[model samples]
Target: MIRTLPYRTAAVLAVALAVAALPLTTAPTAHADDRACEQYLHSKKYQIGPRVNQACRTAYDRGKGPNREAICKEMLLKIEVKPSHAASACRLGVKP
Candidate 1:
């Protein structure tokens, strides 16, 4: 016994399948990821490593540490990182 989809039915199914797969066929916009983090580290002369990359991701995700001075203060007080370096690195771009 042989069965086959009618041409119209098969065409409709093909279109439906294409539509269903459309989303996966395209990529979403990039997020704050590796390149941005690397730039942040390099611009500030920070050691380029996993810890620093994590810090960069955290800094970006937390929108640079609660407030402008928070990460700088935390780093200065707790991590023994210089405030100037912390601020320069954590803040990313908006100068000082």
Candidate 2:
């Protein structure tokens, strides 16, 4: 039993570490996606098209951060906006 204690503790620690890391690993993807969405929203070319821009703006206004971000990414990707610029366009509003 004494010998097994260290092994059990190690196992528990390993599981805890893995669980903690899961979110961190997945966070970048979401961030990148959201950034892409924002950029698409702000681009002059996309803005020139009132219909397209309005739809995106409406969605962004209505959506929570995650949803807006995802939609932004989706729309930008659909329109072939470059990923690097996408994030800048989808800038988040600062709430008071």
Candidate 3:
């Protein structure tokens, strides 16, 4: 039992260290992507209005980057707006 105690202790410590490090490693990458999505939404055009932009931003912040892009692209298509509209809006510092 005494000999086994050291092995058990080392195993427990290794598991604890892994669990503690996992979130730290993954959180920053997730946050950076979220920021990118927010910036993209705030800069996108297409006449999406403030409310729609805000909704998109919120959605992106809530882990919806891929979905947000799909929705925004669909909206642009439905409204007959060009992608350049979004590029211009981003350049002009517009929030819609």
Query: Which one is best on TM-score?
Result: 1
- Once all C-alphas are superposed, what RMSD does model 1 give against the true structure? 6.2
RMSD of 3: 8.1
lDDT of 1: 0.57
Give lDDT tens digits, candidate 3, residues 1-96: 999999999999999999999988877432323234335545553344654454444434435444555554454445554566533322223222
Go through the candidates in order and give each one's C-alpha lDDT: 0.57, 0.54, 0.49
Best by lDDT: 1
Could you give the candidate ranking by TM-score, starting with the highest? Answer: 1, 2, 3
Clashes of 3: 0
Report the Cα lDDT for residue 59, model 3. Answer: 39
Cα lDDT tens digits, model 1, 1-96, are: 134457778899999999999998885755545345457557766556665555555556546545634543354335445566666566552232
Tens digit per residue, CA lDDT, model 2, 3-96:
9999999999999999999998877433333224445455545553554464356345644554664565456566676665444554441111
| Residue 45, candidate 2: alpha-carbon lDDT | 56
Per-model TM against the reference = 0.44, 0.38, 0.32
Estimate the overall C-alpha local distance difference test score of candidate 2: 0.54
